[model samples]
Target: MTSDILLLEKNMHINVFGLNHNTAPIEIREKLYCSESDVPVILKKLKDWGLYESVVISTCNRTEIYFCSDDSNNSEESIKKIDAFLMEHFGVALDWLKNYTYRFCDEEAYRHLFLVASGLDSMVIGEPQILGQVKDAYRMATFHNTTGFFLDKAFHKTFNVAKRIRTETRIGYNPLSISSMAIELSKKIFGELNRKKILVIGAGEMCEIALKYFKKEGLTGIFITNRTFQHAQKLAEDITGIPCPLQDIPDLLTKVDMVLSSTGSEKPIIDKELVVSIMKKRKNRPLFFIDIAMPRDIDPEVNHIENVYLYDIDDLKGLSQQHLSDRLKESEKAHTIIEEEVVKFSHWLEQLEKNPLITHIIDVVEETRSNELKRMMQKMKYVDEETLRNMDLLTRSIVNKLIHRHISLIRQNGSPSLLEIMKQLFKFEEENEKEMDSGNEGK
Candidate 1:
């Protein structure tokens, strides 16, 4: 882990432990949700406890803790402390949570972070939201110089990798928007959306994006309703649709051909009984329902109804998987770009390793020449101060010229083996000088 490889440096001392969507259900995820307001307090708590440097990234899909320290012996203890803090804060049992958590250290942690930034670990492959969330977390960690040299470099590299992924691959092309996929799936079952009277049950961002796709597909006779009638009305006007109050959803269900519901409600908005009644009222007409909410706005049992098609978030996972497979095929090119970047990063790390030693040697040589010239000037006091200064400059220039070729050779051709030799040589010289000084001290 060279100093020049910033990600490795920052993460070289970092320990990460967290649970993500793959390991936890919505019930568990909701419990671990740390609001934006809680970030500063959490950081302060970690720092106060001697964690020193820390960053918390809590999102819908993942919650990760990245903390830095020099104490290897306390690494496990620090992770345990973090786990205890989360258990206390979220009121979740440590037994239930521990199984889902993954702890990474050093180079593995650095690689995992890079993969996360590249969007390879996202629930929705190539989703753009995670990168923004990561950037926000990075920005928050920058306060009070908590980021340091390693984190600063690692994050910048992550951002650059994200940019390269976006540019070099078609991973983002033809992305399966949740709303658009719902409409497209409906079309597959029942022809075009032009004649369908679509009813959106909430005015959430997902519902809005869905509506935009529907409108673009020539969808008309749209109706929107929310708990807050004003929000529903605003969304309705924006899409040139009808606005209804939340209570009217039961009545609206029978009239509309398609229903898209995404509310922040804790319980199901549309149940099996309601859909069964609506299907009866519509005289066997096909009805499509999409529940894009976390706790699920629609009941899973609604799928049992005849002529009723119900799709929840989990249902969309299959479609997302298909899109991800397609994106993966395109990602081969992006992986090539990443490989090229890794090589470039490795070369830079090597150059940085050679720089400090060269600089130290140059400084030592220059200082020696300066001291020698000062002694010579004192002995030949008749020489004018101007002439003495010129001689001093001339000697310094001569030393620099003599060392330039050696410095250039090391910078251009230095390997790990060569660096090891240089380090040993420096150590030997220092040890020999110390021995000589001890001998003189005895006299």
Candidate 2:
């Protein structure tokens, strides 16, 4: 029901609307982020809103909502649906969100997602972690059965494009991640990491990356504590750090110089009261906390306490943002890759749209052949078997020849206008839909 400019075709198309690291600050991004638990609920809400084909990509740097719908004619209406859902779930109104967010439709929306999956849109510029994060989000969507045919196809293609970009270009070479920035932040504060006792919370990918970065540093004691002891022990064994239970965090808090947490907890694991008591044990020594988790594993109140510092994922972005010129060069190479892939995907989409017309062409020719053969038979005396066989063969050849050139032209790469011409040349689909609607009304 949207205008022609917004409508991609008469059917569903991939749509993306969200705020990312470039468009929004960390605070804004975090407020919009949907955690692993939150993704399904938000996706379900969107489904209930008739956005049955959708996916949510929420990370430290971005919170994106992608879905399939027919509001290309007026994307604001489609975006309003997403905006309303966000208002309902994330508590941000449409006007407030529009300033920070961007919207893309059809091919452009799909292209944007490909760039995101390939890490061309990341703060670090071609960071490798985003591809995996995107994959994980799609996997979650698949698990919940939220994505429909279009999304599933687009996301799968996006994964392949991301893989190609990483392989074909130097985009991922010498990349930086949020975990590396956290380590750099620590060095900035302590001037050196040689004597800093580090405690890592959680055994997730973020925590693993932080530990990997920390091991390379000259840090003194490294401790691993997580809710799952087996995971904690495994990471600690690999990193040669001591493994501790989640309960041991209070004791570790007192002894450690820095605590890097990346947990899946909904609530803050470290509060002001707990940290204040721990600081008392250390004679008011300074403690640095880096919380990379989405829901925030460390409380903001903890930052207010004396001799304690707290940094979330957003704070880490500043460190990674430096020297953007070098990464931007690599980003250009990724852009070229994405452009090629976008064209490739668009071609596939056009071919898919034209397929129905091709089917109709074949059907029309076959029906004409059948009706003409029956008339000729009625006008002649008992036809011989050989004559009948020859007639059938002759009609089949004529039909194939008649439509061959038209089908060939449709298959070739041409201007965008060619598709509209092909649709106009074949009116069967539109007529069929009209007849079906009329019949339903009559019934």
Candidate 3:
């Protein structure tokens, strides 16, 4: 049964391996996080190491590796090698990370991808952001031409399954956006945000999301700021708030009740000294700061400041999980859709196994019909052109009719014996032609 399944997948296949929030803790996952700018470089390295096609999805909750290859024997070794590379890259030991990783091959891998894209596999189930992240990864793979036929088909089907899950189920209904979860954490730290002045840094999607949630709480005067003043001005206008230059964060910090910073900067934008000064200016009023940016926008030391509460992106996990429980029914429904799609994709893969034989049979029938027609045309030069054309059509139709049932049977059952028979038939024909050539050489 294993051999038969392998034969079927020899045509097209997928394999997935990696760690996520479910299997690994944030400390372990953080080590595996590959930035968008780092992906092309990693892709080149994978190709150099003889791994042909791959897509790496590295998000806060998961870091999944998906690959396609004609050789199945290499899958396990390839994964181990990748694991070693990640350990070296992140300066972590293999022993610490190995136990957290989970590997899936062939159909299981494909199904897992669908579940991931639909957000069913998220640590906080039914989160909507993962779907976009998955699509972005797919688009990158496509741009790099690393996405082959099997991956292309699998990703397209995964996307369709994700759409069906969203449309058919209430999985996303009343879903807690990450920004809302951030706000929930703020409320826990500070009794009520309504009277507190809120400072939102950055004009990115995450900043906007945070703004919406804070606005819902009727926070005291909101300040929108970004490196790009126009963006800050635009967002401020949209939210009916004030705009501050990014450089003025230190000056404005003392006035704000809460600071929510989510930006693309690689290092901390708000340091301990700056925040300490702000705290002094505010007479050390309890200030809640949420840093949702990768690499973290706020310095870790800021948390130690008097009356200042600093929360990093990972700190919101508890609140996010709490929201996930309410959407459990929708998550189950999404899983059902994923399971059904996996079965259909597997059936398509099985049918593809007979494609080589089907192509061979069609070529042989066409060659035979063409050769016979040429011979008949040469022998009967007096035959009218219309009569000859009609005869040719009749012979073509008869050949197709004869091959139809065989083609249908091969497609339906995908029997290995039938493929072996086709291979032997071709081999015999080649041997007979070689003998005929030998006879001519003797003459």
Q: How many Å off is the CA of 84 in candidate 1?
A: 2.8
The root-mean-square deviation over C-alpha atoms between each candidate and the true structure, in angstroms, is: 15.5, 17.3, 16.2
Candidate 3 lDDT by residue in tens digits, 383-421? 874576467547755886887677777777767787668
- The residue-by-residue lDDT of candidate 1 on 1-443, one tens digit each, is 12122222222365677778988887888888888887777777787777756778889898887876543336788888888888777788988778878888755565567667777778877777888898778777654335543455566677888888888788876457777678778888779778788999889899998889888778758999999999999998888999998888889888888888899999998888878877788898988888888899888888888888888888797887788789988767766666676666555444544355564455466557767876987798599645754574467458857876667767877787876676565442555335434533543
Q: lDDT of candidate 3 vs native?
A: 0.77
Pairs that clash in candidate 1: none
- TM-scores of the models, in the order given: 0.51, 0.51, 0.52
Residue-level lDDT for 259 in candidate 2: 93
On lDDT, who's better, 1 or 3? 3
Candidate 2 residue pairs in clash (backbone atoms < 3 Å): 2-73, 3-73, 6-72, 6-73, 7-72, 7-73
lDDT tens digits, residues 302-405, model 2?
98988788899876665456535557777787788888989988887767554545545555666677789889989999898567756755775677678778
**Error in Å for residue 39 of model 1:** 1.5
Report the error of model 2 at residue 323, Å: 8.3
Top model by TM-score, which number?
3
As a whole number from 0 to 100, the lDDT of residue 326 in candidate 2 is 58
Number of the top lDDT candidate: 2
Q: Per-model C-alpha lDDT, please?
A: 0.73, 0.78, 0.77
Q: Which ten residues in a row have the lowest lDDT in candidate 1?
A: 1-10
